[model samples]
Target chain A: MSEKFSLSIEDLHVSYQLSGSAGKNKIARAVDGVSLQLHPGETLALVGESGSGKTSIANAVMRLLEPTSGKILLDGVDLVPLQGSELRAMRRNFQMIFQDPFESLDPRQRVIETVMEPLEIHGIGENQEQRRDLALAALAQAGLRPAADIGDRFTHQLSGGQRQRVAIASAIILKPSLIIADEPVSMLDVSLRAGILRVMADLRDQLGVSYLFITHDLSLAWMFADRIAVIYLGRIVEEASAVDLIENPMHPYTKALVSVIPVPEAIEGASRTILSGEIPSPSSIPSGCRFHPRCPLFRELGEPEKCLNEDPLLQISAKSESHLVACFFSDPSKGDTQ
Target chain B: MSLLEIRDLHVSYPNRKGEFFAVDGVDLTIEQGEFVGLAGESGCGKTTLALSIPQLLPEHSRIAAGSISFNGVDTTALNEEGLRAIRWKEISVIFQGALNALNPVQTIGSQIQEPIRIHDESVSKKEAQDRTLELLEAVGIPSHRASDFPHQFSGGMRQRVMIAMALSCMPKLVIADEPITALDVMTQAQILDLLRSLCDKYKLSMLLISHDLSVLAQTCDRVAVMYAGKVAEQGPTSRVFGSVGAQHPYTQRLLRAYPNIRHERKFIDGIPGYPPDLSTLQVGCRFADRCDVALSRCATEVPDLIDIGGNQSVACHLVSENQVGVQ
Candidate 1:
């Protein structure tokens, strides 16, 4: 365990047992042996398609769902074993921002009440007055100017962007060490998305808050995240700096995912690698290399038997220590591998 | 000849306070086999404008003035029965949210065949089924799975089914409203490719409505940027999105907000403040409150869409004045 890291997940595994109609038992490995580390004030984005277990990892870290096996360590404390008041106490160190601001925020609660509820639940301030003052300051920090006026309006009265600002205000009011934002801007309009992203970035710089930003938009991940982790099914297929991942993606899935992102400028004669089929269900995960069924490179390599027999571990590349890829065929030294 | 021409079209709905213009004075035209995209934020009335094309507005809503001319015919003056003649035979719609648009209790084939049967009663059941199979295959869905229910398919597959349904009647113009919004990036690309190819093969005109500027930039031949029920800018996709130049500050801001993979990290400035309320009377520019380069006159004078040559038009006092001076 590194002391420099603010949050670390060691071999996290979350599974759900399901009973079939014929009384057969099956296990869905939502988070299958995933591990990640986030430095203080660092932004790490988990980019994947839906049903790729990104939300499950966030849920496990928030202690909303129990992990079958793994260590969720925040500041050297293993949160997997913590429960009751201890878990509640640990929750104060981390907060979450959800996708839909309208659904996440209570319609009846005013902006001030929503932001102050966190402080009240944690029993941080002495009374309502102090909490209200802190909430107002947080609102201003979130770029909602004239905080007192904006704080008086209810969630329904505010725009989608304003509601999201309120949500950010609530998340940062606690001054948590880490914030897990799940598609925070996906629900908002395209123009409003950048504003929320900027707020999150500024908060990290000012308060030294780390972020585990989960989103399906890879382009957004490239724009904001310092480090990008591409997840497939329940495992991290590739993890590298944003620049490295976007410019030099190694995993076959990462390459395909990056190729499909619609850029504003049309690159003439640019051929895209479109994967053939949808992501397989978590309950029926393929054996060996999980992505081998849809791996265009694997088929191009004459159906390598090794990919069908051995599952690849996420291994650091020889070129860069920070760049890791979970594929045997992604050796950058070989010119033909890419 | 233009396939669809909307001139100063205004749609309004009465509320507790008064009538609110959802689709205010807007002029748009789509040539034969042209793909025109309408891009805007939510509640900016892009959907309302698209819905008004087929006269699908709600009961409370009414077309206040102007005209919608399709194929040299005035569509706004058509009655329900008259409109039905052109609805599926000439124009069709692929609505948002494929999951809800499809009926769960019915098979995909039946839903697709309904349009074909309604449009042309002479077609036999077997021929309709064959056409349904062909439509399904065209959308990249396996023909054997035509009997499958909506729930049996993936999100992308359901979207394909929706496209297949929209194309069953072979309409000349298809209005696709956010066809791939919720799907993954890969699926979105596939859907867009399918749409482009289908439009080309059928020589069909399309009106694609989405909040995503990148999607519009990639798909549409020409783009119309709407803000608060007005067309802020309209031009060729290359000029509007590419370096040729975007005249409107709103369009520029929208283009900047989207992260382009080809470009390096650039500062994205969000347009401050929410869109102005539609129910309230507006005398000047709707985007003046958020416009960074707005002049004092901008708050008092509403600018009309002015042509800046090269098939580009803008509705901003700043850009129009600059262009007029240059000319």
Candidate 2:
């Protein structure tokens, strides 16, 4: 709806150089020429399985790991060229939430100190007491009740959900423009997931902050994200609105991903597609269609020549012209009813 | 007689504060070849109940009350040697993160063979090797990869090996605790299907423990919801997890906690508050504090699991009161 995007990733490539023996290749293309955009205040979900380079894309945007090539633009400004102090200065605008709160939080620090650390790092407050006040405000925004009491407790004293709320408090302390949440609820209990998600939603509504929510669960994406991008083998196989993508998945991998989601309802005879093999190691990615080996549609079509010989670039789907897909034989009407 | 029956079981572990009754009065039964699921949040004593089956609890923890009968044998009264003999032979346990429990120094084949050889010492080395390969094939792994070390296998494959080892001695009942929690969704489906097929093919009774309802809904014939060491609800999967059949407040909330791909998008809030402390276990239902529609009597007296209708059991004062109102 707006001309300027909150986060625009352009032809991003992140590859890791391999040492010693690893098949015939010496380099692993973790993320290869992927592009995406997140509008301000919109939640865009990056849906992919392990080793699909979803985290690599997040790390690259955060400059936790330098991209192999291409531009990571923040509000139309290229972040790839920014160095030391500039990158550090730019970091206050964008924050990251990790899957495990234990990994991002310090064990020795009190909850308030951890939340205040961000303000201290950015030099936002004039005094220590002022920073503590700001930290308590952020904690309250994160839905931590009795903010002062919660702030006085150490990280180890809190429950799993409380610990993650503290992590959210720290990430939101500086009122960042963009927050990249990587599998934020994957490590939490199923019941606790919705509460944390609700907290994030309330924050989004209040702060008008954009979220790049990365997760492996499609159902969560369907419930939370406005747009969903399906990634496979370091490439975007499909991208569309959440309802459109789930209702009419063009890519075979996306179809399979949707099929295997076990619904707890007593719906009889819900058929599922379990992909046969694990994702290929990044160093030895298949040419043409990277998902050919596991694509049910490709095999059902008697192994199309185009899928084996020539690569399929991300293009508009035949069914929904607006939907992007990277499969040569993605049919329009093949989405599973289950 | 059922294949496995646990009657009013209570397990306790002593701590600095007091005696922590991790598993308080739980009763469950599994018919021969029945697939049962136990689900709850962490520290809800689902794991404690599963471990008590094979007498796998640590030395300090003791079964304070109740009996666990397997194939008509009283497992609780058995000594260590007797328990060891019955463990892999009659009741094997597939632990959570059991994949990492594999010995990295040994080959996969050798690890599987260890259980087979130990159970049947009279068998020859060749016989044990043949059985190992057969078990591997049963679990969808190629026999040739038997020589591969644990490091060579993927997470799913390592889990498959654990399953294969669990079946090495032809155990009648298998207790898998959160078997697929560490796996991705696709791989988790594969493993669950494999276990389902294996259970059917061998006529083996299985007790699948997981915090997730959907995982159990797809595989288990019956599911039991636990809360703070008590069986909140237990019934057929269709009746317990269906759109409108869940009765207990805890079970109802737990059922909707997961995000279902087919279900319509709606605002779902988690059950508020934390699980009650086991060491300070008190009167009334453990879920009373978190329950939204809890009656005043719910906090004062514990309700027994009553058969409401259609073989469904619920431990809630609300359901009992409704039944009373109807009468």
Candidate 3:
């Protein structure tokens, strides 16, 4: 696997048809001109608030939603161009782990039966017992208990953490190369979130799994992800290595986000850069830079003219090769900001 | 006197197989002008304790033991009318999920006025309207939006309305039971900041209950970690967060779950087992089955809440008896 990138999203654009008053036709661009690449065995966390187009990007990549425009290249092959049975077959290379584990798994089906469905659909495994054994193996890899205990249990019988492990078992049973986790641990308690992350990390190491981790938690993204991509309204504001982004974020939106995260040490009445505005509706995004409405620079400098007139593209500076940001007044390494 | 005190509180529900105790023997106290957070996983009797405070327990359930005192008065002994007198006027509650808690048919203004109307019928409609406007402004919501229904408001704004309703009667203590659970992280911060400022402005005591420790650590003065309907540990937020001698592995595992932004590329270490079922009677420590350092005595004898220095307390065997001597 000497590939340059495991999953490449190139100029991806996703739109939804909106109905106006009196049934008028309108189009809403949910994800616009977003491009990024995830390395093999590395995690690229797509972070944003609700309606920030993070989930839309995830859906577009998983082919759960049709991409109106743009290309999704997997292992040098374009997934967008493929259609019908060919696209369905191509989907086998990527698997999705949903946010709600209890809702994702079938309620009536037993654990073995649920995990076996994927194997059976993929037309792998020889017999029932073999599928059972494979399910047990996947469960064990996810740090589940003995094969006998989990085989006959229903989804409701298990706790949130255990059900998530079961979901992980189901996703990895097919042994896909890419895993799309959309807020996988958001519903669970804090004590169980780390355990799930560890399981995902172990799977990535052992089986070489690339991930598109979507979440609203910046702290988790800073810690777990190899690279962090900040999405706002429908565009990528910034993309950089996790450490670079956390320690020295260039984009104003990213900086505001990082500052608001309440860490234990940072709780001593630290004067944080608090952005004072609400998340705008996706249908009616602000002109120019999507974040211009809430950007402190727009307010403090009283120079909303340029920020409200020109759209910014993610551009690289003289810092790191991988680090990129989309802002009018950003300097990558130094605070020699424009 | 403490604004609120709970001594040996126990809540149980009747089932086909006798009775099931959701909240076992537990004790807690909230001082005046202090913000105490009650944190635990789901089914940890956090909500049960909250419901028990207002004498709002379900018909099938009752306070099997203990007493709840508010403003030096025994709340458990209060009758329906007696509880009503103190409900919003003395101690108010803000339930989780603003959409469900708010009446969709009523305007936000009327919803807020309901508390005032029920508490003091002598106040005229004009006074109620004036009070509603003031409450809305205090919560950062515009007075004009009071005419809007619950559905018209955003999740965060609706939560503000809920807070406005909770503060309508000028209660000394406000019990927010997972008020921001359904909101986004940014909205969550905004609401928390509002609550912090309001608590300061009014000098109001609060009982903030949630399952997320990180969420509570931001605004809480003190925190009590609950497990199996019992307080596993309680102390100042900083000391409890930074380092505490907790003998229970459950508490230790919870501290490890927070993601450290400074330490990138490191994986989180989550706890292994699930919480125990509340219905089952345990002879020893309730967390004994899942505890990593469980001793033989853990299976047969329950650990009492013992002091562990610096105003902290833990109910575990790992901390030396000298360090966590029984109170």
Tell me the DockQ of each model, to 2 decimals.
Answer: 0.67, 0.71, 0.54
- Can you give the lDDT of residue B263 in candidate 1? 83
Model 3, B68-136: lDDT tens digits are 999999998888889989988988889876557788898999999988988898989899999999999
- Per DockQ, the best of the predicted structures is 2
Count steric clashes of candidate 2.
0
Whole-structure CA lDDT of model 2: 0.90
Q: How much of the true A–B contact set does each candidate keep?
A: 0.68, 0.67, 0.54
Off by over 4 Å in 3: A1-3, A20-26, A126-133, A332-338, B242-249, B262-265, B320-327
| Candidate 3 global Cα RMSD | 2.7
TM-score of chain B of 1: 0.98
Q: Each model: TM-score of chain B?
A: 0.98, 0.97, 0.94
Candidates' lDDT values, in order? 0.90, 0.90, 0.84
lDDT of 1 by residue, A218-283 (tens): 988988899999999999999999989999998999999988887766455567898878998888
Q: After superposition, how far is residue B111 of candidate 1 from its true place, in Å?
A: 1.3
Q: Sorted by DockQ, highest first, which candidate order results? A: 2, 1, 3
Interface RMSD, in order shown: 1.6, 1.5, 2.2
Q: Which residue pairs in candidate 3 have backbone atoms (N, alpha carbon, C) closer than 3 angstroms, thus clashing?
A: A194-B270, A195-B270
C-alpha lDDT of residue A26 in model 2: 73
Q: What local lDDT score does residue A255 receive in model 2, on the 0 to 100 scale?
A: 92
Error of 3 at B184 (Å): 1.3
Model 1 CA deviation exceeding 4 Å by range:
A20-24, A334-338, B16-18
Worst 10 residues of 1 chain B by lDDT: B265-274
